[model samples]
Target: MITGSDFYHVMTAMVPLYVAMFLAYGSVKWWKIFTPDQCSGINRFVALFAVPLLSFHFISTNDPYAMNFHFIAADTLQKIIILVALAFWSNLTRRGSLDWTITLFSLSTLPNTLVMGIPLLKGMYGDASGTLMVQIVVLQCIIWYTLMLFMFEYRGAKLLISENRGGDMVMNNGHEGGGAGEKAAAAADGKAKIMPPTSVMTRLILIMVWRKLIRNPNTYSSLIGLIWSLVSFRWHVTMPAIIAKSISILSDAGLGMAMFSLGLFMALQPRIIACGKSTAAFAMGVRFFVGPAVMAAASIVVGLRGTLLHIAIVQAALPQGIVPFVFAKEYNVHPDILSTGVIFGMLIALPFTLVYYILLGL
Candidate 1:
């Protein structure tokens, strides 16, 4: 029973909804209504708890009985193709290594499945759609996050080395130690100092992935939650119904507070917007339009319907995943360009994604 008008309505409503959340957070932040410690507390809560709980809840509800592994394969392949396509195009355009890698990273990564995808799906198809979003996210977590960790760590180390070398050269040679001529020489050497070798990056990425996978609180929380959900762990210790309602209310409010803190972090560093309009435009196009279009056609051709359709759209529509920015920030890739790509993807996908659901008659 869905129609184009429904699509437009849902899209319009949801965009403002998310924007309003951001605006509320921004206004409060600008007014200094919350202390830094309060904001940090929210971040910790969301990063460790609220988001993971949401993920677990979503996955638990979706039976995945009719799920198509082909859709998962298709989603993975499409992302890899887009990654290679952007990498090649960037190289052809001579967009430098850092920029090229970032272009690829932006095209392939997606936002947190829990925070962004589930809410957007729920708006389009209610609670059922939100559950499907979780399944798609689990597939993505397997491939995207694992690879992203590697990329972020390797690139970050290279940047650190480059910056340190540049600083030491300037300090040791600049002033009287070597005078102006020595400074010029050091500057030339600094210019020639390239990023570390690719194998080094590869190794660092593996190391980072291993470390995070084995010990990260976020990973552990998600894993435990999934196990609990799948195995049906619940306490018979009953509290008052009002208390349950109160807890849910508090958690929802906490989630909003956490998101606001993240928004503040994003807003304070406006330099992420400087990655050039073209990069942002290109990245957004790849993530939202090309990626989803490819997914839609592929899903139909491969006979993915119903729950699989639900799952596929969530993956197809999700903005650039947070893992990329996580890796980029941690490993120091083209953080500005990567961050800009991610932000652009999230903002644009917010409004246009409803059309995908309408196509599903949801």
Candidate 2:
């Protein structure tokens, strides 16, 4: 059971973030301090600068050599299960699409492990559980988040290619036809002439995605941090104070800025539940219920038992990660849903997580 001290610790870690969020919210909704353009700029800075540095700081500082393979395997398997399910849904179902897949994947698999999981799980499970949580955070920063970025870029590239191809078809048809019948014939011919083979188009999209991923700072931040971790751990070297301090300056603000950005997003929207009540409720269901259930199955499959298994499921029940919302807003893909997820997810995470803790403890 979580004691009063544990609750205090969690609140200490969380309350300041809420304070930052409400400040930003009041600035926009009540004070009218920041313009729409200014909010965009603030979000851009958080995404490009603070988030990358924060990722690097977490990745580089962790003791990479002390990995728990069982826990890591459980985490990896759960994500793989979610991915395969998403793939099936997208390929075989009429209701599925790339956008929903991306958003749902984020909603179901990624939790606010960095902000909420560490402190809260540490309170519930003990100090050893905190180490496990950090390992999860490091893996998230290195592998899963990078994969999410690639998917976002891939979807963007695919859409851009389709739009360009459609534009070319229109131009070709317009130039070659003088009447309705002729235009229909010309359009069919133009589509045949302009549209590349599916395999070829897929290759082109992959290339474009790679280029965009390369340009993204988050991509390099994780890679460089991992490389630094390997070298530092093997050689017993430490980052110099100046360099460390510089990173800490921005990295320290990452979660706060992310929350502030979330507040700004909420204030600008028509309502706090930006995606409507039904969708927000569905999102909460995925965040709290579906995530933990899937994680429980994955943990059992990976042979996790007792406290570790409980920790796995409970951590999965944590709030929606704020970073994914940042990515959604930046990429313009279902930002409303994501923003709603983060805002309401945080609000209800405590009671839901408490229930999980009591049940798992039983």
Candidate 3:
């Protein structure tokens, strides 16, 4: 059970982040220290530099050989369940969309594991639970984040193709309807110029997504870190102090910078609930209820029981992750909703997580 001292430790971990966020918020909303462009630039820096290093640092330092396969399996299973459901909804339903698939996936599956999970779960479930949390972080950075980036790139490419096709149709229609013979000839030419096959177009989009993923630092940072972890563990090699210090300098600032970016985003918005009430409420439902419910089912399916199962469910109920919010703002995809998720998710996470802890302990 979480004691008063445990809660204090959780507070110690969280308070600094809130301080960074509020300082950024005050700078933007009250003092007007940064212009909109500057805020974007700061967020871009966090996305490109701080976050990648943070991912690398966490991944490289972990003892990959010591991973708990059962816990990892449970985590992977939960994400797969959500992904399959979202895929079906996107393909079959009129109300479903690619945008929501990406956003909802981030909202439901990706909790603030780095900032919130380690300290809180450690306090509740002992130091061993911290290892489980780190394993989740490594998996998240290496696989799921990369997949998220691919989805974003694919969606962007499809939108561009759609717009270009629309423009071409407009241009073709601009040609006046001339004589009957001329019109007949034009229609014949149009019919003869067939579009590429679906498979070919899909291959092209996949190629595009691959190229973008290659360029993304987050992609390689995690990969390189994983490779390093493997090499170091096998050979008993240690990273040099100088190199470690260089990485730690920036990576140590990562969570704080991310929170600052979130505050800047919130300050620039017209209100705290920037995505409005209904959307914010829906996001909360997914983050708290839907995410944990799915995770519980997955844990049971994967044969987790007792404290391990409880830890899995409680971690899922932590909060919305800040990294996804940063990506959303950088990609210009539903930033408002993500921002709301991060901001308000943090505000309510403590109580909600405690409630889960209590219920699961019972």
Candidate 4:
């Protein structure tokens, strides 16, 4: 039987591997193993193809019938509540707003289940936990992704609308252009020409959101795989074994490469550390510590057991997924903060996440 301490060791073992791999990538980059653009291309390939394929593959393998729906429901609800509470708490810090609160909370609460959680669970709990991990990932895909995109897009819209309104007010007067003497006279009157309807701004926002979301072919490929899975579909075409081999390399090697790319990006930016500290701390605290605590407490209160506890542990302990960082990058919302949060969450989650599961004795 795997003891609680053994579980801790599993987590500890994995972190060093991840850290070592990331270091290797860093070393290679420092040595000019790849140009900056090359490194970026690798990161993009991982994010767009490898990661999503892994998600689809892991999720598609499990029999949906094996999932303990009762346990899944209970654990999922607990996770969401804890997440929302953390969002509220972070808002209290005043470092982030309700919008920022939502983004941080969502990102911190949802982990990279395909990359991290499934493997960790399988290692700790064997095949029994794999199916549960799959179900948890499924829930993440449906609920977490929806919430993430909606909140991010909404926040972007809010900012854009406010700026546009202010600009319109300025341009409405003579601020756009005028003769020097007339402009000075008009400025005294504080009057300007009424600007025409640039009011289709909302449509532009929608287009921007859709364009970004669909720009990555990999995201849609995952969607395709998901549909295939749901419809009980399989392709028997004997493609070269090279395809699976390539995917394997992409999924395993790609993660560290991705992380290193993120780190280098952070290293390039000034004020990354200063801007991200508060948000990073907040996200790490909730994700590795407080979030799990909330789930554990809720589990005990509701008398959850076995597979339920295992599922909860997996879900609670997941580090933030790359998708959140992707959005942060797209929206130009403090990449340093986002990168810091990812690094911090992954690092701290190593030991504490194991402890969370061990304490549960699941």
Candidate 5:
């Protein structure tokens, strides 16, 4: 069991991180040092450079084969279950758009597995405890992130194509912008019904989504990490020392940069909260309670034992991911709702995780 000193030690470690967030808030709200655009740029830097390098360094340095497939399967299954349930809920209420659905789903499914997970796990179970969390990060970056990106882009393409088709129909319907004589002539032509270019639209939408996915830096990072892991395992080729050091320097700053950038985002966010009270509460509940509970159950079924199981469950209770919220803002999908949800979720999950560790007697 953890002594009183251990309890204080864990809580103290969290203080600095939370303080960094408030520092960003103060920088924006009081000092006016950073404009909203500059905050967004900081977030971009973290996602494109810092976070990717962090992922690459962790993944490339580890043995991919040592990963437990059962744990991976359990994690994926939990996410899929949540996604399907949310899809049904959205359909039933008619209140869920694709934008909010993906955001809410991600908020429910993806945890704060990077900045928070690494230090928190290390504190509780020693440095080696974070290995499992790194695998989770890799899976999230590649598999989960890719699926969501494709869906959002693909759905957006369909909507744009549909809107364009509607405009074409209006044009062909003799709504002449020219003089009355042109309008009369156009109407008198008795134009045949123009069928929608359905097949062409399908093909075009696919292409558009493909292009977006390929362009995503996170996609490349995950792929490179995965390939590096495989190659390193099979051929015993380590990254050159110079290259590793370069990545290490940037990646080591990722956690601090991410926290400060989130504060900047919070200050610059819109005045109104788009997420409803009930929705925000539901997200927090799932994040702090339901998600961990489900993951715990899955881990048990798959016989995940000891520190591995503990880390998996605790990681589930981490707040929503910063990378996902960044993506939401970038896509103009559901930033307003996501912003509210993430803020509240983080506040609740952080303290709750502390208590959970004590109960576990770690």
Candidate 6:
């Protein structure tokens, strides 16, 4: 069990990160050091360099065998559950359309493993926990992201099919100007030719998904890191010191810059409550409650105990990721859910984790 002193150390260790975020919020909201749009550059700096390198470092340095399958399974299963639930809810409620479902599914499924997971788990558990967290991040980058890309391609393919059908219908309508039997023949032809068959659409979507999966930065970085780890396992191969140090410099800047940018985003984002209070509440509840609950139960089933158990639980319950928010924004899927889910999720991350920590007997 975690002692009172251990808990105190954990809480205190978290203080600096929170303080940085608060200062960022104050800088933008009060002083206007930079607009939220301007902070996009900082986010780019973190994503293109910092986070990838951070992931690369832990992944490459750790024993490839250090990563385990049960943890990945539990985590992935939780994400799949969220996706299915959101899809059902989107159609059922009609409050959040299918577009909103993708964003909310992203928010609930992918936790902020890069920025928040690294520091918090390290503080609560130990140095080893950071490595474990990165392993989880590797899983998130590879599996969860590819699934998201599939969702986007699915939506796009549906739209294309719908448009083709509509165009065919218009053609059928114009054919009515001809002889009566001609119109009937035209309608029959339109119905036959308009929508691409399901198999055809499925093939198109799969090809797009494959192209995107290959091109994703996270995919490359994670695969490379895993390869490096596996290679090093047999023969002790290492990169040149100069190059490793250069990557380290960029990786070092990731966490602080990420926290500051998060704060900057909060300040830049307009504070109007556009999304329903209930939607926001449901997102938070799924993220903070259901996620960890599922992970915790899975951890037990997988026979993870003590620190391993706590780390998995905490990682599962970490705040929503900036990466998923970026995806939502870029795709124009559900900006409201991405924006609100992230900001509000950050607001409660600490208290929510603390509650989980106590209940877990950590």
Off by over 4 Å in 2: 153-191, 330-332
TM-score order of candidates, best first? Answer: 3, 2, 6, 5, 4, 1
**Model 4 lDDT per residue over 6-111, tens place:** 6665765466547654664565445556666775676676667666666656655555545777657666667677566766776667664745566556554667
Tens-place lDDT digits, model 2, residues 222-329: 889888988999899989999999999999888788779878877887777889999999999988999899999999998999999999999999999987887898
Task: Write down the TM-score of every candidate.
Answer: 0.68, 0.84, 0.85, 0.72, 0.82, 0.83
Q: Can you tell me which runs of candidate 6 are displaced by over 4 Å? A: 80-101, 165-193, 210-216, 272-274
- How much is the lDDT of residue 179 in candidate 5? 28
Question: In model 6, how large is the Cα lDDT of residue 262?
Answer: 80
Q: Give me the displacement of residue 339 in model 4, in angstroms.
A: 1.1
lDDT of each: 0.58, 0.81, 0.82, 0.59, 0.72, 0.74
Worst 10 residues of 6 by lDDT: 176-185
Worst 10 residues of 2 by lDDT: 176-185
- Which residue pairs clash within candidate 1? 109-321, 110-320, 110-321, 111-320, 111-321, 150-205, 152-331, 156-331
State the lDDT at 320 in candidate 1: 70
TM-score for candidate 2, residues paired by index:
0.84
**What is candidate 1's lDDT per residue for 1-362, written digit by digit as tens?**
87676566566535654664576457544776656666666667766656555454454444455454676666666666666766677567765475456646556446445666666666666665565566667765555666666555555555656675533433443443334324322444446643334454444446556867876555654565455445542432344568446545545554455455456556556554657888677767767677676666667767777756655765576777665666667655566766776566556665466556555664
Task: Supply the TM-score for candidate 3.
Answer: 0.85
lDDT of 6 by residue, 1-362 (tens): 76888777777668877887889899889998877667778767766767777777767787767566766666666666667778788878849576767776776668888778877877787888887777777777777777788888788767755665533432343333233223222445445544434554566567778877776666777888889888987688888899888878977776777788788878887782346788888778878877787777777877777767777888888888887877777777777777787888888888888777777772
Off by over 4 Å in 1: 1-20, 28-30, 35-38, 60-70, 83-99, 109-112, 154-205, 233-255, 305-315, 355-362
RMSD of 2: 5.6
Preferred candidate (lDDT higher): 2 or 6:
2
lDDT assessment of candidate 1: 0.58
Winner by lDDT:
3
